[model samples]
Target: MTAHLPASGTPGADLGAAVRALPKVLLHDHLDGGLRPATVVDLAAQTGHVLPTTDPEALGRWFVESAASGSLERYLETFAHTVGVLQTADALRRVAREAVLDLAADGVVHAEERYAPEQHQRGGLSLQEVVDAVRGGLDEGMAQARSAGDDIRVTQVLCAMRQGDRADEVAALALANRDAGVVAFDLAGPEEGFPPSRHASAFRTLRDASFPVTVHAGEAAGLASIGDAVHRAGALRLGHGVRIADDVHVGPGGEVRLGRLAHWVRDRRLALEVCPSSNVQTGAARSVAEHPVTMLLRLGFEVTVSTDNRLQSGTSPSRELELLVREAGWTHDDLVAVTVAAARHAFLQEDERRALVDRIVRPAVSPGTARPGRHRA
Candidate 1:
């Protein structure tokens, strides 16, 4: 079932309002990237760690400015502060719990928050202990949301830093907790030198066990990295697969030429977890208006919008959709379709996915409502 929106002729105010009200799914948010500045300040104070600022707004601005340094290395430095405060079980639980509640407030019905367990071991907690802490927090957060009448489901994606040698260990951890709210395994961190093939053993293990996988590709690197992730790592989704746009050519009369790899990705209906704001901050795209998301959608690619790092990028799922609409002239229908695509590709059981599609995505995109802009072939 697919929901359709009215044409772009609808009033801009109505369009934005409807997009915000639409139930959304987020699959690429990071647990560390969504921390509230006040939470960071409080945690730092409790842990006796010095912060650049105790003021919440200033700290938030510091994170945005630090992440905007135009280099992945600098962008990563911001996480050092965030992870510094997340070294203990209590801290982890607090961050995870608040993250879910925040997503719920943004009208996200489903979300997969990823983080590296290896990063949280500074206080001597084992990998499983870190996982347990986050799980407890998410469970509590979900319960709290339900009691508050906000229906939200959250899952964890255990990420192994590509620069580290713990991919295999992380894969094992994910499999061990498959039934404990751990939904998928991912390879994150610097994507330039640390190719997905470096973690071949981990990918193979996940593949053999049929564990879902998504690799951070096409953001720091280009199509070659995306190719390796798809062919070698068996990635079912491409995290920030923005650079796949490099393979697409806009010909005369608005026709598009898709390279073989791009064609295969689109044809197979593999999800592209595109984060617009983060892409611009990381220089993946020049601007939201210039993002290839519109092109990919027009070309029939399975694209899902996400907030890669809310605090770091200063964005939310609603804000991202709003940016696309205002900057790229997108409509509510487009937002609904993208949200539905995300839910469809979520790392949930088959029956659960179908139920969400029927109950959420379908109703959100019903035809004669404002339809999304059509792409030129």
Candidate 2:
């Protein structure tokens, strides 16, 4: 029989353990939003940055509730605390490294955690310095994981804030470190007024350089935003492209009709970085079971599950898989499919991605083949 999860939303039985053991790939996670609560409290104290809660537990709770407010502004407000404390190079390194450690513990074989370099320059460090610090942290974290016998590999994605004026600068920064630890360039931050079109020139610069780019669209915005990100911005992957669900219509007899924009994304096999918990927290979906990822997967859209923010969403890749298995009714096969999809779309070289798939992902997902790893709960 095919592996299945328990009926309850909490998959503590075989399903939960199986989910945690699964070799996963994460495409969209934020560095600032995934800090350990105690680390945040310590960093805040060191930086003299006051936070909503000094208690680590309380501060962690605050991030989750605040993000669930459904107002992107309120959700983003939590970042001020995390980012405030992460201005220094050491702080950035710790956060990036620890974030990778956490993902490693979650049994993620490959991950790309992104951050806006422009936001981390308050400590008199140049943008390139910020990139170097974060890259260094990722290297250190992966090394530590390797020491612990956890097979994990991670890379950085340099993000440009949407409301900022440094998209091209960030793109260039990505290029500067592409040979190092950085894998891709992305446009992040609020997606409402400042659409991808606002950074068309920067996107063109990255695309012309043959760099991979993923745009934050279809989360706080709709199809117009998604269309622009794909057509105008040359996004190989879409950050929270959940609103692509808007273009899908179901007929009375159950036939599916996809809009042109949806057709373009689907036909191109563009990966949709679907964050279920964060989507509910942001009102993109009413609940995990109601997530459009269910439809996207059913329709054969290239859907890869991820945790947009670990501290804010209170989730990990394993938790994300548990949620889908318990609520979205996903099976082991489904998880394997998405993991492979993410590896294939990853911004790394073709050989590296194939190695991740063939050696780590494929073997681990097989019935008897095993790949050694660890999971955080």
Q: What C-alpha lDDT do the candidate models reach, one value each?
A: 0.88, 0.87
Q: State the RMSD for candidate 2.
A: 2.7
Report the number of the highest-lDDT candidate: 1
- Which regions of candidate 1 fall more than 4 Å away from where they truly are? 1-6, 9-11, 14-16, 364-377
Q: Say what the RMSD of model 1 is.
A: 5.2
lDDT of 2 by residue, 1-377 (tens): 13344433444466655666678899999999899999999998998998998999998898898899976777888898888999999999899889878887777888998999899888899998998898889999999999988988888898999998999898888888888888888898888889888888888888888999998889989999998899899989999999999999999999999999889999999999999999998888999989999899989899999999999998888888888887877776788889999999988899988998998888878532333754333
How much is 62 displaced in model 2, in angstroms?
Answer: 1.0
Clash pairs for candidate 1: 3-365, 3-366, 4-365, 5-369, 5-370, 5-371, 6-369, 6-370, 6-371
lDDT of 2: 0.87
